[model samples]
Target chain A: MSLDASQFEAFSASELAFLAEDELITILPRQNLSRMDFKGWVQPALRALRRSEVPLWLAVILKRQDRCTIIYPNWLDATYLKTVLEAEGRDSASFAALPYMWQELSDTILAEAAEDCQGSVAEIMRTLQELKELRLNKLRQGVLVNNDSHLRMDGIGSAELNLVKPILSKTMRTLQTVKDAQEVETV
Target chain B: MNLDLESIINSVGRRGTRTRAEYTTAPAQRLKQWWVAERMAPHLLEYQLDLLNEVITNCRSLRDYIEETSLTLLDEAAVESLGEETLRDVKIKLLLVETELERAKFVARAYKRTRMAKIDLLPYYYLQQQESQSGIMSKDEWVYCHHRTELEASSYYKGFLNAFPTELQGLTDEDGHISMIETPDMDKPVVVRVNTDIGTLKIGSEEVELVKNGVYLLRFSAVSDYLEFVDIL
Candidate 1:
């Protein structure tokens, strides 16, 4: 049976959570921290030095414990994002090559480590939100322009793909309807 | 088992009412039926059902693998060789397995819904006959029958019962004097096409040879018992 909207939403959210767990985040240890053996990553040295790379889920845990500080990546930097947003001018294609989990990871880090971060979490969140909206708009535009039923947006994570799947399906259906109407008119 | 037509009718009606009520608010409850009737391709349902079973088997195997691996990780030698690449590979595989399990679960739910819908459509007398012939009733069918009886006095259930063959009514003799049909054994021997070499299997007293790309008939019981070894065509 066709999955209803709510069922689909739940499925998408769960799949997104699984995807977001693998996303990498840089963290700076405030003190020497022993590595916790988990499924996702290679076990680091017994004592992690000042800086270490960890999955977003682990980073959030470390941040919550005040064990480390999250390092915001260059792409997530306010100035850099603003520049890309301006240059791309609402084109998702340019941003398609960007990290798939960038938005989700940034938002998560901002929420988890808002108190520990040096800058305002709200400001970074705003910028990230804006970038996400722009990218989504571009994705929608791409879907409308493409005739194929499948909308293949490279570099989009499973979470993002699930989020926009319904919209893409609807767009494809609308396009089909329009094409049918035009053919009938000509005939 | 003796067939109770009245009880069966009542249960069917009860179930149909409950299902109808549930369907009003949550059509997803009938998703499998909808998928079968509208979305599924011809013969795809059988494949999907097989795929669902395969996925379940894989999930169980993966779980066993994880448990075994975790125990191995406790070993000093195993821990030492658990390099970054190995850990990453395992994690990726586990993630893929989990995703596949989730998809399989969705398929399974849809499949169950379709079966329930089929049982709902069948009249109580027909369902009873099927149970008698098969010597078994699926749990879903039992539940459906129980619910149908709850709606027994309703006009809807009466309408369904009325559509059954008039001659069949005489077959439900309350005195236990109804003659039993000599139905063929369900465990009768059947032929199967071997897709892959499965070596040999013991069917009753004989050791049956199974060659790759070979066709042979064997008892249904034996074939079902070793379904993984051969494909039933």
Candidate 2:
């Protein structure tokens, strides 16, 4: 049947990776293989250059094994990330849209091929962390000021939800108490 | 207890005509069939176990929802003039759902019981096989086996520990005193900066002066109770 956002959010990384969009990656094949076989994804024909568009999880595995090199995304550029960070500082809610599997893919790439990449992995990681913090701060502010009982946020993964759930719950409790006190005073 | 090689081969044969004919052709063929089945059983069983757990969880939720809806309908029928035929139809649907729920619950429990029995006997089987095969166990295999046992035991202990609250699950130190159970409160001490002119605040037995715009660290549990007054940092 039908599934809700929360249910889909609880899916494991592997399951989510299956549904993730394919990214164009340049992989240097270690062997002269005719094809690449990753479970749950289509087997792509290996070219002479060994570069192919593949899912994020498969790309990470291939990169980890040193079977291929994944070309970094343009947004992962140090200059672009720095600009984004500045923008976030000015308006946290106005940050640019991220890829559906941006968090998982970036984490995998940094973990597997941090040293091998052209740009420093630490810088990329720092930018990602800063963006996450900015979004979380925006969420906290909204919770405190907004009177609505239900808070709807899209594009938040299970990992991010877990990080903010405790604080959000606490904020809701405080809001409820304030509402109760006001009602009693009026009565 | 005896390794019924013939019976194992016969069972595997029943699944395919080719295998059935092959089993009776030669002793080597019979042995091969038995070997294949033995190798595949555990892997197949593992997949089946996972599928069973998923089915069980889904069925439990469905059953609970149906039960709740049935109660609500019954209450409405009592207050309003719902038709007798419609009420009877609802009751029949509820009965069928209850039956299916019971069947699902029974199947889940039976599978779990059988799996637990097999797990409980595995160590004994390994010990006996080790004794008979004497010194054949590789160092890596020995370590792997012991690690699995340790993991199983620790998981059971963890389930036991969950019965106690975080503040009571501390281990006793060398001085025979229970150590403070570290929780989120201890890990992330709640610090607040007082904006308004507040008087002295007593937390537990200690009293601290609250000055305007003064920052102070307070116990998370204590402050959480009155979180409306303070701004959490």
Candidate 3:
């Protein structure tokens, strides 16, 4: 059966999961957290997915269409996206999900400090404080997530965690966008 | 490569611009005129064969890629980056191949038109003309004659009427009369009027009532004859 535009409005997570399993396509948002003003980005981004007339294979598997709105609408837009990526020293090709953005931020600002200022209580305090603040700000703005969102990060080792900790603690919400795309394809 | 501005300017001035009308006959028709029908047919056949081959090759490659890759090895993320690129490439190739197919169809149409123009269409016309010059006389002894006083004398009454050539067999006399013969016995002349191509003809004694109108053939008879001509009375 052909999908009607109206059918997109009330799809549930279970229905989406079933679709993912059967058709190997998923178009639902991976995370629906309502922190800060994130809903403003989420609604429009999800709306774009409803408007797309992509094939079933594309619609189900590359669930990127829906998750992109929540985590990366600004990046999707041509000019602002370029500015944001450029600020973090990332180009179009290297810009993956939000974690990549955080890595860029950490490498540029915090990575060297974590190593050089070890054992200094004052420096340690400052580093922890800084990372906490970043996380809190993202949480408030609904731009990213911290450990509060209840998402498990499996398959990542300790070294990878250390590398991702700064960004993931605050900006991991964007990973939902990637998960959403994967779920669509799996179905 | 060398500095020669003055010479270049003189050369430009020597040549003048010419203008002509825009519309020209299509390339396919021009091809038919240049190459005979037999040669054009083979070229058209070859073009269709080549188009089919290209489409088949493209489909095979796409099918191979789909069959060989697994969802895990080439997961959604990997496909996301490359799928759009592949679709775009295929779209361009399809459009180029379809243009050749359209050109071949145009050439085939031109060949058909050229072949039809080489047939003959004029046997029945001459038969009708012969009937008019010598009107048909009935088996009975009757003659058809027309009396003309000096005041009514006209060029039509003054000369021997000409016979129509074989190509115009359907020709008729001015009065819708065809040919005439001597009455079975010596009797008043009877005029035989026939409806044929254009004007009718009067024959034998021109005394019969002149029919200004043409006669219509019966549908079944006309179909059987198939060579009759129609004209305004």
Candidate 4:
């Protein structure tokens, strides 16, 4: 099989992370460098001790080389995550408006650049786990009760959405066809 | 069944991009759109001939530049004379290009291989489609599809097809009865998001109100015409 078997399915975990790496983030440089063109987009030149916005992939490379420190986004802070966790509980009908790639971005930062972050990593992880559970629970409930042809997925994070894709698509299609058949018989 | 179907049926579908974020679709953005749609779609989609050409050309030149610079740096005479700062700069630039090149290569290879998998599954079915609709396969892909069917036909004849009765030896459906060629199951369910408000779309016996940014689960055939506004997830 010359083909990558992973392509047959929805975005895999690594592939989603690859896509998330394209979302721009701030990183503080330890050395200065001139602007470089990436063909798709251009990254501005960096100066020592200066904060620069670059795609997360570049930041990861720079960080790996001991040339830069990635600045943790505000949403990943323990305080901010607590608030969003509360928001998740308070609103069962919709997802908290997190960045579309919030799960992947936060996970990557914590895994690769945890030392530069300000607070407790365990606390952040716990909060994220709870948030994931709450939303996934809600999604499960939504699927069971939806009965409609469409699933309301606005504000759902990319990781969470992809998690339920295969099952949700199959379940909803079966429900839809059976519902349509029943409706026709009733008429 | 009504006005929407008649007008949109002949219109080709272009996957919707995020107008809210960037109105201009960059090369990367176009590649993302085509890659996702081709993977998620059960059948082969309109081949992205132009986008692949642009990206492949860019990658080829970048690969050449990387090779040229790395070779230059490898020469001890040249590296021994350069200042530390310049050497470090060249190395960092090389690393950046190498990393970015891997990503671009992934997208290009993955996109093409995704289509090839579908083509190899049932080459003759797509070859049949080339007569009615030609845009689905690129010229190279068309040749590949042609060769696969040709190879298969010859292998069939060489093995057991030569010994079979003359009337039963034909591989294709000629009597308009049982279908010897398999086509994609368009009725297969697909998960799609409606990026634009296209009002109510009739799916089966239900009329789905595709509000802006609303996601829907629909049969591939029902929403085939409106894919310009809908994205297969």
Candidate 5:
């Protein structure tokens, strides 16, 4: 996820985090505050003990300041992730569905607001690690059988896709060039 | 509220194949899409002048708001000296405003840098072939490209190109089958996420079912025509 000179086409880890910060998350405010105009959209005023929706970045800031606690998104729940992990194990050919920015979002929650999460933090982390490894293994296997003209990447999340981006694009281009040369030879 | 840029950009909803008309009016999302598209596309896309203007206006308004509020805070401190809770509220509001402004500024910088990277590639080619991108180069972009092209051509000439035959001194020659001009590789493979059901689209010798949200690796030329429905990953 680190940016290098040759990897300009894709987003870096920090850039991905910046993009994911826009994702909305529900938070419970600890104090009453007036609505904030976030330039584009207005964040509703926070009332003590009441749940309100705010972008993940704002939620993280407030959480750090002890003004709010973040409610975990449904997909990030431990029980839900357990099922997703099992599904990835169930299918070796395809990946299970996850949000596009799941990697960055989950990392932020775990790092900044673990106390506000509903489930055991360690268990969620363990499940997430397992899911990451299993999907990566499946992708490695998929590469063994990748064809020249096109490849199907059905359920690869943005983070996972980004990690394999350089190799994936290079391999596809090389295979394409070779195939085109062979066709020219045949003609 | 998932708020993924994809859903937000496509949320205006399509009545059929007219997705182009539904480009989201949300300034942030528009700027984001422009940035991402510029990064992803094989060729230079149209200059998003309207979107850039909107972002500039928004940034100015935010700066004014921040400055005015800060003065008010200072005045209150000088005269009344706000109590504990009131001061905290004001500080938090100010903090949020500054952070959002920084985020917008980051987007603005990142967007310009992304285009600059592309513009630096074959600047003279794009200058001569403006029609290829529908002449979407902004005035500043034009000046930059022209200056870069001149600098690059002059350096080459000084270093070595001056010694070549007079006929061979010409660059950007499209006379032969193998043109001297540099162009983006349209046939290059790119990853694309289908925003809508584009049905069956052909890729090389293969046909792919581009179902909504399905990802595939295909040539840029094939996906370029469906920019409204396909997001290059």
Candidate 6:
């Protein structure tokens, strides 16, 4: 079914079903997939398909999931920063903190949430760390900063380090609390 | 329900792609799958024509309800308010409620739009099934799981990033290969390779040059998509 953009328009529920058959993502079944928080996957998918230069605000309604899962893969790619810099006619490397801002937000939220949760705390903490690690690695990888001069700003000039500090403190406290609770339970 | 509405109901598709053959040809398969669609087609048509009639009646009732309630509230507040400031506060509260009502109406409009979207998708599904070698499914039988999957892998990922904004961090290069950035003394350097089904975290000083720290998150995505992650040296 080679359909033009016009043809793809005005889909009925049944047409949506046909589209589902062809276009659905094949992930691990719900039982296995249940172990992870898949709600975080939405942004990367949207970014990959970002053709419109003007950013569009997404309002997602998941069929299976109750909450609207908004994924921001901004932490995964630095193109957004480069785009902003290019848009401003600046050197671009100066604003490498764009993606890091996103990472810090994720880490902050997760760290806060992990404060009380017991069962999924470890997993969530791991995920947040992974996000942080990705951002740091991306910074050090130095993909955009052409020369070593641009790299000089590196970790020192992040728009997100302030946000990251509080998140780290919260995460540490939560981990300590959880460890204490575990020890008390053992006793 | 009346003859005039019935006549109009039968006439809607005539202006579109309904040919003489389509009108004359009996849809036997449609009878089996969408017995309700065929049987209720006439009733549905009648309903469509009378929709305006029902809507008009509803609007009249809503108007009457609003007028009655607004007048009652206004009179009650007017009698109770002793000071000008109190009256002003009452009016502000009333204005807030009115604003809430308008907001609710906007939500209702959006809900109707989504309902219309579902309704519009129906004909496309019908046309697709009609042309298929396999038999058509009933409206109730239709599922969008597969499409949802594709959407999740692509669109959902992007939407998630927008809302949470941290799913993707720190990528300055896009050279088709994954790149890892090394940070001194950062211990939890987990190397997770997708397609190989492997995960290794650095425990000691043994340095593993990474394509990037992003390999772990990508591994998560791959794993979420049910792909194996293989750790490569």
- Cα-based lDDT for every prediction: 0.49, 0.47, 0.28, 0.78, 0.77, 0.30
lDDT by residue (B1-233, candidate 2, tens digit) is 23345323533443224322432332222222222222212211212433444556656665775767577686975625657755544554455345435544544544444333333335434434446774423343345545666676568568786687765553422234643222122212334445565676664434666666444444444444444355433
How would you class the docking of model 6? incorrect
Q: What docking grade does candidate 2 earn?
A: incorrect
* lDDT by residue (tens digit), candidate 6, A126-165: 5545534545554445333221110123222223333232
Residue B49 local lDDT, model 2: 32
Per-candidate TM equals 0.42, 0.35, 0.15, 0.85, 0.89, 0.21
**Among all windows of ten consecutive residues in candidate 4 chain B, which has the lowest summed lDDT?**
B11-20
- DockQ, candidate 5, comes to 0.42
Query: Least lDDT summed over 10 consecutive residues: which range in candidate 1 chain A?
Result: A38-47
> How well is each residue in A1-187 modelled by candidate 3, as lDDT tens digits?
2233222112233323222221111122333312111110111122222222111222222332232211121222334333443432432112223331232323322332232222443443444344444443433343233322122222221223333343443343344445456768999
The CAPRI quality class of candidate 1 comes to: incorrect
Q: In candidate 1, what are the lDDT values of residues B93-165, reduced to their tens digit?
A: 4444444345435545655654454444443543456555642345455666557645652554466656767
Chain B TM-scores of the candidates: 0.36, 0.34, 0.22, 0.82, 0.82, 0.25
Location of the lowest summed lDDT over 10 successive residues in candidate 6 chain A: A28-37
- DockQ comparisons of all candidates to the true complex: 0.02, 0.02, 0.01, 0.31, 0.42, 0.01
Q: Which residue pairs in model 4 clash with each other?
A: none
Every prediction: chain A TM-score: 0.70, 0.63, 0.17, 0.88, 0.89, 0.23
Model 5: per-residue Cα lDDT at residue A43: 64
Against the true chain A, what TM-score does chain A of candidate 3 give?
A: 0.17
Model 3, B125-178: lDDT tens digits are 222322564322111101111211121233433332234353433222233355
lDDT of model 4 at position B150: 88
Stretches of candidate 5 exceeding 4 Å from the true structure: A1-5, B1-25, B76-83, B131-134
Best by TM-score: 5
